[model samples]
Each structure stands twice: as structure tokens, then as C-alpha cells.
Target: MERIPILRMGKFLLITIQVDMHDTTALALQDDLMAKIARSGARGVLIDISALDVVDSYIGRMIADISMMSKLLHARTVLVGMRPAVAITLVELGLSLRGVKTALDVEKGMELLAAALEDGDAADQD
Candidate 1:
């Protein structure tokens, strides 16, 4: 079985999708990421999909699901590097990805995650 690599960066988890994802692969990623978040106590997730040139409805829904699941596990998820066509496809497929945060690139994604974590910390203090 193929598995996506999830890297730990301080209090965040970084996932760079370098291969085209099949349904099984995306499912496995969701499971793996949830477990990683629970075990590592990561506060944020950053996913870079720049390498992907295409996205079907399944993959788009999976991305949205992953973001929602991460939130349930108390982690903020930021999706980065989406191509215009992929965005159009997702919209056409009616997967609004409502709860997923997005950035134009990894640097901005990282900044978003960092700021989100800081906000979470501030909320915790209150």
C-alpha cells in the first residue's frame, strides 16, 4: 500500500502531494493525518498540491473532508498551491471546500498556519 509522507514542522504537519492521488491513497492520507495529529499534538496542517495538475470530484471532496477532520482533531488546515483549473473543477463539481483555508503558496500557507496557531494560543489563555 502506498502512503503519503507527513512531515512534522515544529507544531505543524506539512504534506506535499507529489503524486496523483487515487481514492485509496487519499483515504489513507486522511487516516494517517488524523492519527499523526492525535499523536504529535500538531496544531496546524499545511498541504501543498502544486504538483497536481488535475483533480476529480473524489479528490476534491477528500481534501475538504481532510480539512474538516483536522479541525475536529483540533488542528487548523491550510491548502496551498492550487491551480486555477483545479479550483474551477472543484467548484464545478460543487465541492466548495467551505472550511478549508487556502493560500497561494507554501510561504503564505505557513504564515497563515502560524498566525492561526497564535490565535489559538491566545484563545486558550482567555
Candidate 2:
């Protein structure tokens, strides 16, 4: 079994799953991640997929599902660290991501989350 580590950075949570590049693990991890995010009440999420080499339809749909569920939980989810080859494969496979957000790296995803958090704070103050 692989380890799925979840870390909290400010209002953002990062979930890293160490698993084979397969959809089975991805789907299971996605469910666990969603539960953790909902329970933590995180404002944002960064899913580090840097270790993954393959992105099949199931995995893509799971990612998209998590993104939608995260929004319903009042948290934004971003898929980060996807390799160009994997990205191209996913696109070529015709896997629709719906409205899921993605970033080239975790740093950019964090920046986006921080900006959103600032905006949320401002809106709360007004």
C-alpha cells in the first residue's frame, strides 16, 4: 500500500498520494482527499501529481469530480505538477475536465490560492 500524505498550509491543504501510475489508486485517493478537505474546511487545495506518469479517463474524471466537490465544500481545488506529456495524453484522450483548474506547478497553484484567499478576505470585510 502507498502512503497518502495530507498537509495544511494556511487555509490551503495539499494532498500527496504515493501510488503507481494507475487509475485504481487515483480514484481511491480522490475519495479520501475529498473527505479530508471537507473535514478540514480548507479554503484551497493543491493536488501534486508530479509523480504520476499516466492519466487515464478514470483518473481525469476523478480529478474533475474532486474539483467540483471541493467547490461545493467552499474550497478550490487545483491539479498541479502535471507533465506536458501527460497533459497532452489526457487532452488527446478527449477527457473532459469540466471546470477544473490546473497549474504547471505547486508554487503557481499556491499563488492562485493565496490570491483567492485575499479576495475572499476583502469580500468578507466589505
Candidate 3:
């Protein structure tokens, strides 16, 4: 069993998946991430998946589910560092990742997340 580490930066949670994930590992990550978000009251989540070369349908759904779950918990989710090949594979596999947000890399993901959080703050203030 592999445990994914969830790091906290201010009000955001950062998870860099450095290992090839099996179904069990992906499920575990989903569970662990939700727990961490609940415990830390994180406002955003950044998932870096640059290291992963393959993402099957199950893994694709897991990613989308994570994003939806984060939104349900009032946290914005940003998937980052997806390789071009992975993107094409995902599209061909028919997993649009419909409601999930994505970025090219971690730095850009962080910026995008910050902007989203700022927008949420503004919405709240209004």
C-alpha cells in the first residue's frame, strides 16, 4: 500500500504523485485527500501528475471525482503537470474530465489556484 503525502501551503493542499498509482492507491489518495482537506480547511488543491505516464479510465474518474469532491468541500482543485501524451490518451479514452480544472505545470497551477481563490473571496464579499 502506498501512502500519498499531502502538503499544506497556507490554505492550499499540494499533492505531487511521484509514483505510478494502482487502483487501490488512487482510491487511497482520494480518501486521504478528502480527510486532509476536512482537517486543514484548505481552500484549494494542487495535484501534480507529471510523473505519471499512464492514466486508465479508473484513474481518470478518480481525478475527476477528486475535483468534484474538493468543490463540495469548498476547495478549488487544480490538476497540473499532465503530459501531452496523457492528455491525448485521456481524450481518446473518452474521459473529458468534464468539470475539473487543469494547468500545464505546478507554478502555473499555483497561480491559477490563487486567482480562483481570490475570485471566490470576492464572490463571498459581494
Candidate 4:
């Protein structure tokens, strides 16, 4: 079992989850992350998946669930740093992450998240 590390970056929470390419662990991690996101009241979430070599259907569903949970918590979720191979695998498997947002790196993800938050704030002000 590996620990899921969560860090606060600006208004977003960056979560580094370690999965053993297993669905059980990934689902557990997703639940834990959702709980943390709700508790922390983060404006956005950045999930770093650079360490994962492969992603399966269950894990893909978990990722999608996390994205939905983030929106329910009033926070957006952005998957960051996905390996090219893993991305290709997911795409080939027809595991479409339709409503989820993704970025090539954490920095870009954070920038996008910040901009989204800013736009949301500006809209709210009007």
C-alpha cells in the first residue's frame, strides 16, 4: 500500500497518488482524494500521474469519478504529467475521459487552473 500525498499550491491542491497499476488501490485513492478535496475547499486539483506506466479501465473510471467529485466540491480537477505511453494506451482502449481536463505538465495545469479561477471570480463579481 502506498500513501497518497496531497499538497496545497496557491488555491489548488496538488495530489500525488501512487497506484500499483491496480484498480482497488486506485479506487481507494480516488475516494480519499475526494474526501480531502471536500475538506480543504480547494479551488482546483492537479493530479500528477507521471509515475504510472499503464492505466486500465477501472483506473480510468476512478479518474473520471475524481473529476466529477471535484466539480461537486466546487473545485476543478486537472490530470497532469501523464506519460505518453499511458495516454496512448488509454486512448486506444476507448476509455474516454470526456468531462475531465488534462495537461502535459503540472505548471501548465496550475496556470490553467488559476486562470479558470480568476475567470470564475471575475464572472461572480459581475
Give the count of colliding residue pairs in each prediction.
0, 0, 0, 0
Report the Cα lDDT for candidate 2: 0.82
Best by TM-score: 3
Model 1 scores worst on lDDT over the 10 consecutive residues at 90-99
> What ordering of candidates by TM-score runs from best to worst?
3, 1, 4, 2
The reply for model 2, stretches above 4 Å from the true place, is: 1-3, 21-24
Report the C-alpha displacement of residue 37, candidate 3, in angstroms: 0.6
RMSD of each: 0.9, 1.9, 0.7, 1.5
Candidate 4 TM-score, true structure as reference? 0.90
- Tens digits of per-residue lDDT for model 4, 20-55: 655666767777778887788888999888887877
Steric clash count of candidate 1? 0
Residue 29 of model 2 has an lDDT of 73
lDDT per prediction? 0.92, 0.82, 0.93, 0.84
* Candidate 3 lDDT: 0.93
lDDT of 1 by residue, 1-126 (tens): 789999999999999999988789999999999999999999999999999998887888888899989999999999999999999988887888887899999999999999988888999999
Model 3: per-residue lDDT, tens digit, 1-126? 888899999999999999988789999999999999999999999999999999889989999999999999999999999989999999998999998999999899999999998999999999
Model 2 clash pairs are none
**Model 2 residue 98 lDDT?**
66
Q: Could you estimate the TM-score for every candidate?
A: 0.95, 0.86, 0.97, 0.90
Which ten contiguous residues of candidate 3 have the minimum total lDDT? 17-26
